[model samples]
Target: MSIGRTDLNLLKVFEAVYEEHNLLLAGKRLHLTQSAVSHALRRLRELVGDELFMRTGKGMVPTGRATAMAPALRDALRRIEDSLGVEPFSPDSSRRRFVIAANDHVTAVIVAPLSRDLQQAAPGIDLVIRPSTRLDLAEQIDLGRIDLAIGIFSQIPPRLNSRTLMSQGESILMRKGHPAARRKLTLRDLTKYPLVTLSVGGQEEGAVGGFIVERGLARQSEMFDRRALEEALRESKQEPRSRVTVPHSLAIPALLRDTQMLAIVPASLAVALAKSGDLVRRAPPYKAGTETLRAVWHGRDAHDAGHAWLLERVAAAARAAEEALG
Candidate 1:
């Protein structure tokens, strides 16, 4: 195949299809229709004189030639991007769209402030946040779909890079007039009140240490330190009586209002939620261990100018959050 004859644009569709393993999904990521994506693939195959992928019951399976070509092709794309993107980003003028992943709590605590900052500094920049707790979050990052993920990630794969935003312990959030909101939270309060905790996935869902290892991606499933909370109760010769479980921190606010349920949540989330004035936060008696909120991204964007600027903004927002609740 002649290098001069190849259309570089087709490489993008190839990369997308290779990552997603499905034509429709690849099209969705590229903002192209299914027929367009298929047409591009057909053209690329004809140009290369090989059928790059095969349709299988499982998904689009790459042929041997395509598999062999992936590494160098990806590196070439990265090199091209780096060369073209090294210029300093002008936030005021750039209309860059960054896709970030975070749980609802971090979205509320971090992304929300970051969005406000961007509005003032870079009016044209847009932020798209996906749930970091999703099982496909790691895959999304691997595929370059998610530019950054901000959340408590216990385990990260080698291909990805991470920067810690803040370290926080657990705080109990309850309605302002709840029976225990008037005073400090005791382990007894944990045992007495029907506790509500966040669990995105669990042992039943093939998760270990609150993380589910799926297709080279270990994502957070259970949101809280359930083991520590349960162990504290067992050490006291008491059995846990967790009455409720919710998938997100945001859900607790509405559930706690006019109720006696207590939620063990990140201190930052508690502080942020307390701003509504309906919730009161207090330190939990048992050690919940420190959870680190981090910004994770694919190594491919390590030096991309726009990505770097967004990261700077994320770090600043984290610092601001820490100060607000410090």
Candidate 2:
């Protein structure tokens, strides 16, 4: 179907219906009467040559065809809206909520400061922090469900625009007054203690494990393999040493305090904890893989004023974090 011939309003009705899953709620969201919504749906059904949606006990359920077209329709509307500049960007006036995908590690290391700056600079802006995962990032951005994604993404889709925010390595952390804190940590010292490692983006072995392998202190292994190592260490030693696994980098400090455990975490996190005097940070004995945190968005948002504002703020925040760590 030709783009110009299609009724754009129909897509809006479809999107509201799909999201609300109830014609009444969808009509309310669109500021339309139930009859008007039904008329729009009927037109859409005729154009698409399908029922589009069916009334169910749960709500209005989209047909498979309608579900498939939703993302593209959403993208089309977003592109048109952005091109027309329908919503003029005024940080102080615009009260639009932006959803950002990032993990707690990124939040602890960066967003705290970024959010503070945003509050002072753009009081009308609302921000939602969502979990950062590899699933559907590009698709979500395209559909305008997520405005930006920050952190290390293993893969980048061709249609997205991205800029590297910062590069970092990992560090080893131990609690104050712990036996391992008295001496510079070697691989043997690390192996002797139970470990608490941060798992970011499913990478558990992380930089310290890579560094250990690079230094010939240990063999290269996956995070699962490292977990096995921890299990063997626990079973082989007469005294049971405890090993704990956590997801966020910020949690490492609390986990290490008054415990004989050590953690490998992002350098930014380690530095933050060290400045607080709650933990001591040391370099890993071997070379671990480095990570490049990047800010990514859809190409359609490349020239959007609000999106541009967000990018500038994020880049500024990244620089501030790097300088503070330095």
Candidate 3:
């Protein structure tokens, strides 16, 4: 296949169809008819000597060849658009949709406030949240499906770029009127009361250096530093009665609403969750060092105006969240 003989428009159609997964929608996006989109796809497939895509009831599924072509193709298109001067992004006037990846806690702590801020400043913009803990997170970012990922990412691939949001230590959260709510959280208290914590993954799932491995990508899974907590426990010679471990941080409020179960969570998240006035936050006796919250995205989008604008807003939100934590 000669690259020079291929129609560049087919690549555009491919990108739109790959993203929308429907020829009609892709055609509408490209301002072409359904038949025209089909024709271009066929020509491109024949030239490249690959089926490229397969039609399914759900939509058009890209073949392995197309999947392999997509990330680089989209990146090239972004570069081309940037070189040709893409339209200026006006959040207030533009109806752009930003897909951000965040964990449930970050969504509540940071993204929730961001939505309210957007309501007044960029009313026309839309936000889509993706779970940052998903196995294919990096792949999704590379495919341009997720514009930004907000969380504690300790290992960022070379292809990706990251910006730190805030650094936070662990805090103990317990319901009001709890046995320990009246006093500072101590290792002895952790040993006495049944503890609840969040764990996305553990050593069984191949975590090293406080990160969990999934789909070849290492992500910070354990919300707090286990080694530090264990070290503190050993130094104090206390065995914590850790009973309930949950996957979602949002469940902590209900879990601790009336019971004596205490949770060790990120201070920033503790601040957000404590807004209900039922949860009390206190410094833990153990020395769990600070964890940096960050936003990660494909390096290709680092310079895109819209993405840059979203980054600015997310940074501001992080700042606001940090301030609120204090």
Candidate 4:
């Protein structure tokens, strides 16, 4: 059947159910009763000739065909919403919740200041911080699962828009009385200690660990390798020592206290920790090029007033955080 053969309202119900997975929740979101929602789903099934969703133990599960229709349906709905201007976004008056995907370290540095500013400006605004996996950024942004993402992103899908907020180099972090705290961190010194490095799964090529490799200071090491470095007492010519494995940058400061562990982190974060007396920041022994922290959003939201406002605030907060660190 042609697209004209099906009712658009049925597609809306189908899309909501596909996203929420629970009929009751989907119905509540669409302001429809359970029976009405089910009827819409049935109509959709008739039009598509597929059992779009099957009952699962906890909620409905989409069939393969239903899963494939999700993105197109979502995109169409977004376009329709934009065209109708049915609900113009009013940040000061609307109770819209915005979801931002970012790493823990970025959240620690940006969220607090941004939250305070937003609350004072628009008390009704709700902010949700979600964990970001590198692999899901493009998909999440495209599917409207995440409104914006902020971090040192290297791989931005061609369809997305991004702007650099600030650039940062790598630095070493050590606790206040540690031997390395008073000295510069050379490659040899770094290799000598038990290191703690931040890692995120599915990061882009030439991001994160690649910084060290690009500098010729150290080769790319996995989390397990970092752990082996920590356990080895003496370094051998054949087997390189392992360092401590940390997945998030914010954890570095707490781990360095009263231990010989040293961590490499973004200069901005290192400076922030140093100012709080949580850690001492030192230049890395070798030259690691700077990475720019960027604010990214789907191109569809480029002209959106709320999205634009949030981007501006994020940029301002990043600059403030950098200045505070300095």
Candidate 5:
């Protein structure tokens, strides 16, 4: 197709459809009616001479040709926007919607405060939080569906950029009156008492090298350092037994309320949960490695004024969380 014959607006519709996989949702994203979006799609399809998307029970699935065209089209659109110059972002007056991806723990520690800050500084803004633990996180960011993601990522592709939010190691949590809560926990205590740990992905999900890789981005699979725990268990000649392995960190308080189970979790989460009178946080018996919480976003937004403003608020919230940890 010749560039002179193609309407640039149609490319925007195509990108939205390819990212959302639903005509109505794509139309909402592009601020167009469904029929208008469909008309644009029809024009683009005729210009490209391909069935770009197939309507299915699930959604609008992209055809092979559409999939092949997506990456370049997205990059080119971003460049065009940059060249055209974005409007000044005034947080006090701009009514904008931003979507972010973050897991439950990060939602609790960082996003919670960020929301409060937004209420005061940018009340007209809306924030939509999606799960960062989804397997297709990188794909979502690449498509511009997610403004940013907050989590621990092992390897980030060059197409994306990241900034560390907080750095923390592992800590153990338990009921205040538990038998072992009176003293410092030892390696033997890990095996003697039933344990509960958080794990988002495991061997069944192709989790290797301590993370799960998708679309060239590697996200942390297990929250703790499994290698360190296993080594410690070997040295003590004790078999490790986790009575409960869960994915959600917020449930730890209820899980340990009246039980003997001890939970190994991120130090920041442990600190937040331990604020309640019933739970106490302790340093892990063995050397639990540290992990950095980072906010990742597409490199194309590096200079976008609105995106930069949101990231600054995110950093401020992270600082508050760090103070709470201390």
Candidate 6:
């Protein structure tokens, strides 16, 4: 097992394949043809005397050996790049593509502004947004497929770094002319009016407390504090009733339009949707706790020029969105 016997370039191919899980995609990432990628993978398999990856219907599934070697190898490659120094990132000319993970709520509230800023500042750069609510979100970030993730995460693994983008509380949304729209939201209204709430996953999906944990990362499962809501309901001697339970924030406006159903959602999202003039945002009667939106990324990208630029742009967009709520 001499280092001299192995072509270092082949390791890059392996890294791309491990991150992408598709030979064609790996080839695209490295600017190589699909056949060339296959050849490099074959050479590496022979050099290591093990089948590092197996072609399957879903994608190239990595073997146990490949999984065990991934973290260290990826970190070593990043270190090598750092030592050699990468070209300075020029936002005006670079054609680099950045992949971000976020739910529809963040996409509407934060990423929409970020996209507009990128259009003017870096026209050639491509942006791709994936759903952060996916169960494999942690794995995707760890594998380098997603450059950044924007969401409310309770626990982040030590290998990843996170920063708060904004903090928001729950707000009740209703149609403009609804019967209760003119008054402040109260506990009696909670039991009187039918409600609509957001829940991405529930106890059936292994959600504990109010979060769903995967790969040592915890994301909020329930957007609002269920305990606080229930306690307020108990004081009224009534039970909370949800007329509609939806998984997406974008669907709230439609679900409440021309209906009596009231929706409880993040204040930022409520403000964004209410701009259409059909909906209105109100503070909840109870002290609904606030949640902080955060941007999370791998430690390997901490010093990368392109990543830092994108992060700054995202933070600016978040700040703008937060200010609008005031």
lDDT scores of the candidates, listed in order: 0.82, 0.72, 0.85, 0.71, 0.88, 0.88
Candidate ranking (TM-score, best to worst): 3, 6, 5, 1, 4, 2
The digit string of per-residue lDDT tens for model 3 on 1-326 reads: 66776677788899888877899978876779999999999988888889998999999998989899998998887787789886677888876668899989899888998999999989988898988877778789878888898888767778888899988888999998998888777788888898888887667767677687554456788887678878888888878888888879999899987788989898988988887898899998877888899898888987788889989999998999888877
Error of 5 at 321 (Å): 1.4
Residue 199 lDDT in model 6? Answer: 86
**Which lDDT value does model 4 have at 49?**
94
Worst 10 residues of 4 by lDDT: 212-221
- Evaluate model 1: give its lDDT: 0.82
List, residue by residue over 1-326, the lDDT tens digit for candidate 2.
55578888999899888766799877876779999999999998998899999999999988989878877776777788877878678887666567788877778777878889888889877787887643444555665667888876545666777889987777778888888777677656666788776554333443454322211112112222344334544564533233887766667777887888878777777787788887888876555656677887777667778889988888888887777766
Off by over 4 Å in 4: 2-7, 31-36, 55-58, 120-128, 134-136, 182-188, 202-242, 303-305
For model 4, name the residue pairs that clash. 185-285, 226-243, 228-242, 229-241, 229-242, 229-243, 230-242
Candidate 1 lDDT, 1-326, residue by residue in tens: 67987888899889878867899978877789999999999999999889999999978988978877775676577778778864367999876678888888888888999999999999988788887777777766765668898877667778888898887777888999999878877777777788888888777778887878866666667667778888988899886568888887888988887888888887888899899999899987888888777888877777777888999999999989887777
Q: Which ten residues in a row have the lowest lDDT in candidate 6?
A: 79-88
Off by over 4 Å in 3: 2-7, 24-36, 213-217
Kindly list the per-residue Cα lDDT of model 4 for residues 201-222, writing each as its tens digit: 5244444543222212122222
Model 5 regions lying over 4 Å from their true place: 17-35, 51-63, 93-96
* Higher-scoring candidate on lDDT, 1 or 2: 1
lDDT of 5 by residue, 124-160 (tens): 8889899988888899888677899999998999999
Between 1 and 6, whose lDDT is larger?
6
Q: Which ten residues in a row have the lowest lDDT in candidate 1?
A: 214-223
Q: RMSD for all candidates, in order, please.
A: 4.6, 7.3, 2.4, 6.2, 2.8, 2.5
Which window of ten consecutive residues has the lowest lDDT sum in model 5? 79-88
Q: Local error of candidate 2 at 285, Å?
A: 2.7
